[model samples]
Target: MKIYIITVLLILLSMCSCQTDSSPLPILGRHDISETDTVYHRIPDFKFINQDSNYVTNSDLKDNIYISDFFFMSCPSICPIVKKQMLRVYDKYKDNDRVKLVSHTIDPKRDTPEKLKKYAQKLNIDDSVWMFLTGEKGEILDIADDYFVAAFEDPDAPGGFDHSGKMILTDTKRHIRAFAEGTDPEDVDQFLIDIDKLLVEYAQ
Candidate 1:
């Protein structure tokens, strides 16, 4: 009887462990959350110009998981390194329709649609899966805040603007699922794992 009870307890413990391990990533930003609550925060609606001069909006990205980053065509600092890391992600999901990448330019004055198109071509980016976006400076700055990334113009900063090198992962519902330092390959690898986990979560 003791052995039977021990076996039952072991099974229960294993099930609980599995449940903990499989818990979905947290929904970031200010929210009223509880230990038992399952409500999630979502990304707000937005509109911006893509490399192809088309207006890309939040609705266009419905039912897809996307990675987002901020950059400018003229940035001479971490932008290149970050783009390299972003390319790594792009290469991984280039063929997956369910995945997309949105690169926003903080310097909209210089990164017009035409310029952005040239930049994308130089990078050999597929406009369908990867979009290099630009728009009004103020609007772009406000949107950056929503993703928890910093962006602002500074005369002393390199490229005339300063921003964080963060790659953010968002789900179809626009909930931010993960983020990684765009300069760190190890962090990005972990983020890729998280992306897979989110994909599986949504698949079910």
Candidate 2:
């Protein structure tokens, strides 16, 4: 009887252990661990002009988890499909102030604030919810590297530039938590689920 009781208690303990384990999303980058502290890879501060011509910096997004991507207003391929998938994300979380979406223009020279403003208006999204940003071409490309998205000027490529169609999910601490191929609806569908999972982590 004692042996049977021990087995039941062990099983109960295992169930309780499972119930208490709650890391739904792993932080997606490298970390540095010391005896007393662990440091994570953080997105650094940046400044850009949004479609509304307002200055946006890393501080603007403080305390908010966000989705980010890169594109140019005049892209001849892939960008439209990526934007469509991003729109689905936007529609799902538009009312959630805890979330925001940022799209940076790779063609900074041509995609000025006025140009981005016109584009944003066509999408009928509030600038506060989804910001279209323009900044130095070099800075935009540099930040793309931080997000692990490939972007650069290419004369032979479509629209005179080459870039990836990736959407990255970032946490409030600036660590990447999830991402998906923005051109693939199926991947984006999975990404949407991961976003919910990350939010559940915060809710806990």
Candidate 3:
């Protein structure tokens, strides 16, 4: 009887340990975004010019997790705050090969490829893993829409475009797995947590 009880106790302890150290998000309540639609919908494909003026498509980013945010290079307000927060993220993961960062200029009309390159350098962007992209206005809007993010021209607004300052995290499968507020460093902690979770899952 004593031996049987000890075996049962060992099994319970193993199960408890497994639950405590599980990889990936534990099955919880509903997610903020639709995780199911991505599993079944037709994947979006669009080409956009990168900071180098080279075309980048969904296919180009396969097998890597990427974080994307939108801002204009000439903005005088919240854009700078977002960019500063992103710098922290870049510095933390510059040497991480499997991770990438993409910043899309909402005002592509003024942010030419050369201008973007200069802006990136000014920010001390991690060129090895980060890209500041610019392309035609329509193409940029289209790609933003495909990601279920929002951007629109608002001539009345200071920058002529009303864009959200949010950073979205996409898994290697091209599904958006998490989002963080772009202007707040505290919100970036959530981004870091999700990134770590995705990396562990991908490793498996």
Q: Evaluated with TM-score, which candidate comes out highest?
A: 2
Full ranking by lDDT: 2, 1, 3
Which 10-residue window of candidate 3 scores lowest in summed lDDT?
Answer: 34-43
Backbone clashes, each candidate: 0, 0, 0
Q: Which parts of model 2 have CA positions greater than 4 angstroms off?
A: 1-22, 34-36
* lDDT per residue (tens digit) for residues 53-110 in model 1: 9999999999789999999888999999999999999999899889999999999898
Ranking of all predicted structures according to TM-score, beginning with the best and ending with the worst: 2, 1, 3
Candidate 2: tens digits of C-alpha lDDT, residues 1-204: 999999999999989888944567888777889899988877878999999899999888887899999999889999999999999999999998889999999998899999899999999998899999998888999999989899999999999889999999998888999999999999999899889888886775
Alpha carbon lDDT at 130, candidate 3 = 85
Q: What lDDT is reached at residue 5 by model 3?
A: 100
lDDT of 3 by residue, 151-180 (tens): 888888777888878887777667777778
Error of 3 at 31 (Å): 12
| Candidate 1 vs candidate 3, lDDT winner | 1
The candidate, 2 or 3, that scores higher on lDDT is 2
Show pairs that collide, candidate 2.
none
How many pairs in model 3 have backbone atoms within 3 A of each other, for residues 3 or more apart or on separate chains, i.e. clashes?
0
Cα-based lDDT for every prediction: 0.90, 0.91, 0.78
